[model samples]
Every structure is written in structure tokens, then in C-alpha cells.
Target: MSASSAKVRTITRIAMFAAVLAVCSQIAIPLPSGVPVTLQTFAVGLVGYALGAKRGPLAVLVWCAVGLVGAPVFSNFMGGPAVLFGKTGGFIYGFLPMALLCGLAAEKELPGRIFLSAAGLLLCHLCGVLQFSLLTGMDLLKSALLVSLPYLVKDLISMALAERFAAALRRIPAFAHTKC
Candidate 1:
């Protein structure tokens, strides 16, 4: 393909993944600690694996920007600057780094992809726990136990699924030609 065409394709893919992130954010089940169990992380992993380090974080950033601008694209359809600065904001913001780290690792072999994705998720959880503790006036360790612990297994599952999905996608002609 021509250079311009390739760039357009990349941009289109980024936009599509951003939309997927927004959609996944809406599939949330609220928890008592005021955080939600959502598919956001799953989509984050998928975007990272599919789009790679450069494009993946762009998609995540776009989704975050949309939510920050009051598009109701966050968990439980919540959005706006208030949500961006709220207790759960750290997790949301952490998606950018997660995508970058995960995508970078995903460009390697399968084991590397899985390991890095888990690490990325851990980073996200750390951000969430820290912010949750700060905003809610709870002890940091307590917040980590309450908020981060409960979600570890599920997020791992999501990362595994994203890896599988990305592997499958890489076989397709369109994606096959694309590089991380």
C-alpha cells in the first residue's frame, strides 16, 4: 500500500478502537467501594495488542479525551471533568500507560505479551488504589486490598483473552501487513 493509504488505515483503526473502548466502559457493574468492574481493561488490552505501542495509546487517549469532554463514555455512562478528577480517575488515566506498555510487550512473543499485559494491569490497579485511597480518605493498604485485590483474576482473564484475540487478528490479511 502507499504511504498515505497506510497512514489513513492506521488512523481509522485507532478511531475504531477508541470507539470500542468507550463501548466497553459502559459495560460496568458498580462495586461498594465506588469503583466498577468493567470491560474497559479488556478493551485496553485488545487495543494494545492489536494496534501496538504507538497507535494503541492514541486510541486510549482519544477515549479518555472524549470522556473528559463530557461524552458520558466512562463506566456507568459517567463522564466529564468531574469524573476525570474523581476517585476512579487514576485507573482511567492509567489506561494510556497500560496500552503503551502492553503494546510494546505484545510485539514480542506470546509469553512476553501475557507477562507485560499483566504488568500493565498491575500498574493500572496501583494507580486506582492510590487515587482511591487519596480521594476517599482511606488507608492506602486498605484501599489496595479492597479495590485491587478483588479484580486481579478477572483482569488476568481479560489479558489472556486479548492475547488470543490479537493472535487471531494478526492472521487476517489487513492486520497481517501492519507492524507494531
Candidate 2:
């Protein structure tokens, strides 16, 4: 493919990934503290695997921007400037760098392998812990152990599954040109 065409493809992939993430945000598992756990991160990992570093973070940025415009794209259909400026805002805004850095770290093969997914998950945790500490005023170590560690195993599994799924998707005829 020509350079221009490749850039277009990358941009398209990022848009598609952002749309998928917005949809996934609706599938929320409510937490006791009013914050919910959602499958958005799973899509985040998938986008990173499918699009690699450059497009993956671009996708995340799109998602964030859409939500900021009162799109009701977040968990429980909550959105708008208030959604970002509220208490949960930090975590919401944090998704960009988390996905960006994680995708950058995992930017290796076409479909991210297990090791890359694990590393990406770890990066996500690090970003999350940082945000959690900054937002909640908790110590970094406490946030890491309490907030980051509990979700580590689950997020790892999700990342691995997302990577494997991307690998499978890339083999299909429809996605052949996109390279998934």
C-alpha cells in the first residue's frame, strides 16, 4: 500500500476502535463505590493489539473527545464536560495515556502476543495506579496494592483474550485489507 493509503487505513482503524469502545462502555458491572467496571479496557487492549501504538492511542483520544462532548458514551450513559470534570474524571481522562503507553510498549507483532498483552496490562495498571493516587489522595503504594493489584489478574486475562481475539480476527477475509 502507498504511504497515504496506509495513513488513511490507520485513521479508519482508530475511528472504528473508538466506536467499539464507546459501545462497550454501556456494558457496566457496577461497583459498590458508585464507580463501575466495564469492558472498555478489553476493547482498549484489542485496539492496541490491532492498531499498535500509533492508532491505538488515537482511538482512545477519539473516545475521550466524544465523551467530553456529552455523547453519553461512558459507563451508565454518563458523559459531558461534567463527566470528565467530576470525581471519576481523572480515571476517564487517564484512558488515553494508559492505552497509548501500553500500546507503545506492546508495539511489536501485528497481533500482540501473550507476553506483549501482559506487558500492556501492566502498563495500564501503572497508569491507573498513578491516576488513582493523584485523584484519591492515597499513597502510591496503597493505590497499587488496593486498586491496581485486585484487578491485575482479571485485566491480564482480558488483555490476553483480546490479543488472541485480534489474532483470530486478522485471519478473516473481510479484515484482510485492514490487517486488523
- After the best TM-score superposition of candidate 1, give how far the Cα of residue 112 lies from its true spot, in angstroms: 4.3
How high is the CA lDDT of each candidate model?
0.89, 0.72
What are the runs in model 1 whose C-alpha is more than 4 Å off?
110-113
| lDDT (Cα, tens digit) per residue for candidate 1, span 1-180 | 899999899999999999999999899999898889999988999999889999999999999988888998999988899998899999997888889888988787765456677778889999988888999999999998998999889998998888788879999997888796
Best by TM-score: 1
Clashes of 1: 0
lDDT of 2 by residue, 1-180 (tens): 799988877777789999998998899888654456778778888777777677787888888898988899888988798777664565565666556655654555445445555655666667666766777788989877776666777777777777677777777776656643
Off by over 4 Å in 2: 1-9, 101-116
What lDDT does model 2 reach?
0.72
In angstroms, the error of model 1 at 50 is: 0.5
TM-score of each: 0.95, 0.78
